[model samples]
Target: MTAQAVIQVFILVLILAGGILAVWLRDLLAAVIALAGASLLVSLEFYILQAPDVAIAEAGIGAALTTAIYVIALRRTRRKEKE
Candidate 1:
């Protein structure tokens, strides 16, 4: 197989695994981490598709902001659960 095909398969696996983990994982934090990985992979795919603006937005908003928000929310709720 060609290198490009191999890379494509790898990316596809990452994306699918991330999706599955995000859905099936019981821990909120782990789901967020998996989703962040998916976001980064999507951003890379966008870059490969020659959409720099979309890639940047996905990296910043999808990977960074979403992850930060989810983590913070999880911490907050977990603290409440402990109380």
Candidate 2:
């Protein structure tokens, strides 16, 4: 396989791992971070595939904006207290 193809495969593997970690993590904040990492990796894959516009949009919206929103929402929620 070509170097570019190899790089794409590597990125895909990392993205998969991040997604799994996001699902497996018990902490909500950690899961959000893992999801953001996957989003960034997807953006990188898009850039490697010669889709710079899509990559930029993914990075801005998926990685940055979405993560920020999730984090803010998580922070605003109150945890249940044991009676």
Candidate 3:
């Protein structure tokens, strides 16, 4: 396969791993961080796919704003899992 394809595949793998970690982690903050990582990776993938607008939106909203909101909410709550 081509180098670009390989890179895309690698990014996809990272995104999948991040999603799994976000679900599996017991710590809420850690989970959020993982989700943000996934979002950032998705934005990067979008950019690589020639969709700069979507990439910027995803990076700004999904990675930055969403993470900020989550962190702010997290600050007012517990960080550990209950189970």
Candidate 4:
């Protein structure tokens, strides 16, 4: 198998594991982090698959923006939980 294929497989496992962890996790912040990790793995897979456009979109929009949104949401939850 090619190097890219190996990377793709490895990243696929990461994505799957992250997804399962996100679902099974009890902590909201940890779930958010796991989801972000899955998104990053998706971005890596896109890069290995040689789709630069998809890679860029996944890295920029899916990973970064989504992670930022989740972080904000987590912060809000923390504030609410504290109150």
Among the numbered candidates, top lDDT falls to: 3
The parts of candidate 3 lying over 4 Å away from their true place are none
Question: Who wins the TM-score comparison?
Answer: 3
Ranking 2 against 4 by lDDT, winner: 2
lDDT to native, each model: 0.87, 0.91, 0.98, 0.83
For model 4, state the Cα shift of residue 72 in Å: 1.1
Q: What TM-score does model 3 achieve against the real structure?
A: 0.97
Ranking by lDDT: 3, 2, 1, 4
Task: Provide C-alpha RMSD values for all models, in order.
Answer: 3.2, 3.0, 0.6, 3.3
Clashes in candidate 1: how many? 0
lDDT of 4 by residue, 1-83 (tens): 98877877888998999999988877778888899889988988888778989999999988889889888877766622232
Q: Ten consecutive residues with minimal summed lDDT in candidate 3?
A: 73-82
Clashing residue pairs, backbone N/CA/C < 3 A, model 3: none
**Candidate 3 overall Cα lDDT vs. reference?**
0.98
Q: Tens-digit lDDT track for model 2 on 13-60?
A: 999999999988777788899999999999999999899999999999
Ranking by TM-score: 3, 2, 1, 4
Candidates' TM-scores?
0.85, 0.90, 0.97, 0.83
At residue 75, candidate 4 shows an lDDT of 75
lDDT of 1: 0.87
